[model samples]
Target: MTSPAEHPSAESPAPVRWGILATGDIAHSFARDLALVDGAVLHAVGSRSLPPARAFAEQYADEKASPVPYGSYAELLADGDVDVVYVATPHGRHTEDVLACFEAGKAVLCEKALTLDAPSARLLVDEARRRGLFFAEAMWMRTNPNIRRLRAMAADGACGTVTHVRADLGFVAPRDKARLWDPALGASALLDVGIYPLTFAYLILGRPVEVRAVATLSDLGVDLAGGATLRFDGGAIASISWTQTGWPDTRASVAGDGGRLELPSPFHHPQSFTYARNWEADEIAEPLIGAGYAHEIIEVGRCLREGLTESPLLPLDETVDILAIMDEIREQVGATTG
Candidate 1:
């Protein structure tokens, strides 16, 4: 419920320096967003290869900005000028990469599905706290204005206690040995893409008391499609589905005693929501700077600029809780990988 724009520390500090740790697709999106934050500076970029590092740095750097290109992640984290590092690695590499950044005494804003399981998630969080470093899962939806407003409306009884929720996020991923379909790369409908709907339910319903899940595994030995039913203490329930093998509706809707809320397109990057009551319906839209991920990156800048170790909106605890649910869901679906 906290608003970064309203934070009192907004007036007192300079920009937050960033050292990007990957040169992947999401990394580009994040870099573009960071550029929108007035006081945020992109100091450097690092990747496993020299070409990618140089290419990424050139794309985000300005004539005045001195962005170093490092062929190794260690070099990126070693920069004393970098206040925080953004991790955009694969699902399997997240735990190790994030832990390394923490050890280097840099704050981190990692892309989500934080880790493959709960244990790794707990370890990363504990280490961040112990090191007094800011660490947050980039579950960007938590910081989205539309999502924020939706949660507020739900909390204010706009949805009347949120008795039941249904969310589905799925897409047709091209078949390949790459992460999206590769078992070794930790590709699965649930972990790779399903986390959004699962996180959505958690954001609205809190942690569930019981989790029931089922999935259809691909020949690659990874879950290509799945669904889960989560039950909370007070009879509140959530049903979520995800798939990487087929194109799905990819929508999110919450049903309450009085009404329901519907998100039209990218449920996670929601731009609008509709509240319906019998014959009356109203739709509201929320626009963003670019791709909506910009808001989250800007928020990270805000938190660091103010010397805060954790974001009030997307705290590490909520991330841990979301990962715990994912762990359980994975367990029930019998998709176990380290």
Candidate 2:
């Protein structure tokens, strides 16, 4: 746990320069949030083709910052000006993209479900450690102020003898979208949106001793919807459900003998949460911040400034562990990667 001041790289005074690795919707969202941070800059963008990359740069340009556009990801990685690269490529491409960034001597903030499987995640983590390059999954919710507060409260035993945790996230995704149905792209509810609920369970209950799951696969063989029950060593249980075929409640809760915490709908990036002790009135927790992505973006900058190879909040081990859980769930549900 070295402080930023003690780390040698902290001596640098320049703000972090970010290079986005793709021009997808998520990439655009990240660029928008990056604008909200004082010292962070969207310095560059890259895509497989030049037009989309240039178009993204033009679309996201601000008065003070106009990002350089690169025709290919290789060019973006080669840019010396980019201190860190945010890998927004599809799930199947995350491993290659992040590894390339490391090889190019750039730090990384890769999007979540880090890769299609645990083995790929381990390779990335191991490489990051070997290079001492800053790396973290874009689990932005973990950086949310309210989530931080909830974790702190839970750690302090706000919920006495925690026994059960429940979470779910689902939506009716457009079938026409190739990303949602294309087997080549690693499309599945579990890998796509289900990761959120699974992560919520892991955050509240820690790693599970056993994972039991069932899923409904689409005609194309990817999961359309799924559910899992995780049993922990301490006998605590977490039940998580998700779907892409239809919308579910999309709420999350952590309950115990003494109290419970309830996040509002869309708990993954919740604006507020309610806490209740026994029969007492509910206490609502709310914290303000920009489009939610800013927290993780700011976190990447902080870790880079601190000369950290990984975030203390979202360590590489935890990221890999979560992916392993997904791997197991996929195996149990018979959802094979096409």
Candidate 3:
């Protein structure tokens, strides 16, 4: 394992030049975190129009590194200087955007949910593999140091025989938000926010053998809230839920015969978690770091430098499985992505 600090050595290998594919709010957050990474550079930002791209570049500009702004995504993809592209477009646009980047021979770190459906997700993953390019779903939680520690503990049997996992994430998204209510944009609570809890369960329990789910739909025929119960072949079970119409506890827990581990609120990016073993006193595990995005950014840079096509931490196979689960849930709930 290369130390995070060991990136961009004294020999001064050029930093991994990044081209961002959208100028949305999430793109801004990712750009802010990219500045914190030692071996990553925000080389350019693209939007359907040039004004937003210019404004985003101006907001994140640094004296030593200023990103160029492209008026169109195609222009950004054609840039020879960009080594990798971050696809931060809406969920509905992910498939086309990712394929475009892959065709351009650029490595990609696409945002979570990867795509609106399993077939699309598979296409992205398979294409990236065939081309031998670095590709990963940007599930930043999986890259957090503390989450890594928790995963290690589970694997070491610190929680005894894992029996159950429960996780939930929700927030009151405004009714007028186009991304949440518009079906054309792939609007659905399950894809937008539920993915975190689903990913958490998959990390601990692997792929489920059966999935049962239900959901509430908005006027636009998109899911506003939903829950799913997953049963794994190993006799482990996970209950997960999410909503865009209300804020829920947002906490998570994993239980076993011996004890349980409790993740604090906003479980997705937890800085610490409580571990209890049988009758022993509860122990706190806290491994702090900068805003969570840097971890994944660092991992992407590491894999690219190592000539790897996928991250061992968040493999493409696992991403496809997660999306498949979401696809099933969508069918059960009658949420239409069209």
Candidate with the greatest lDDT versus the true structure: 3
- Root-mean-square deviation of each candidate, in angstroms? 3.9, 3.0, 3.6
Error of 1 at 18 (Å): 1.0
Q: What lDDT does the true structure give each of the candidates?
A: 0.82, 0.86, 0.87
Q: What stretches of model 3 exceed 4 Å from their correct place?
A: 1-12, 279-286
Error of 3 at 149 (Å): 1.0
Instruction: Give the best candidate by TM-score.
Output: 2
Instruction: Give lDDT tens digits, candidate 2, residues 1-338.
Output: 22223323556666678899999999988998898887788999999999999999999898757999999999998888888889998888898889888888888899987999999999999998887778899999899878888877777788897899999999998967887888788898898998998888888888999999999997778998999999998899999999998878899888888788888888888887888886785656666467789999878877877667789888889999999999999999889664
Writing each residue's lDDT as its tens digit, candidate 3 over 252-301 gives 98888878888999899988888977677565656554678888998998
Residue-level lDDT of model 1, residues 1-338, one tens digit each, is 11222223557565667888989888998888877767677888999988999988888887546689999998888877777788999878998999888777788889888888778888998988887777888888888889988888888888787899889988888755488777677777787789999988988888899899999877656888899999998999999999987788889988898999988778888888999978889997777667787788788877766768789988788888787888777777777454
Q: Between the candidate structures 1 and 3, which one is better when assessed by lDDT?
A: 3
Query: How many clashes would you count in candidate 2?
Result: 0
Clashes of each: 0, 0, 0
Better of 2 and 3 by TM-score: 2
Please identify which of the two predictions, 1 or 2, would achieve the higher lDDT against the true structure. 2
Q: How close is candidate 2 to the true structure, as a TM-score?
A: 0.95
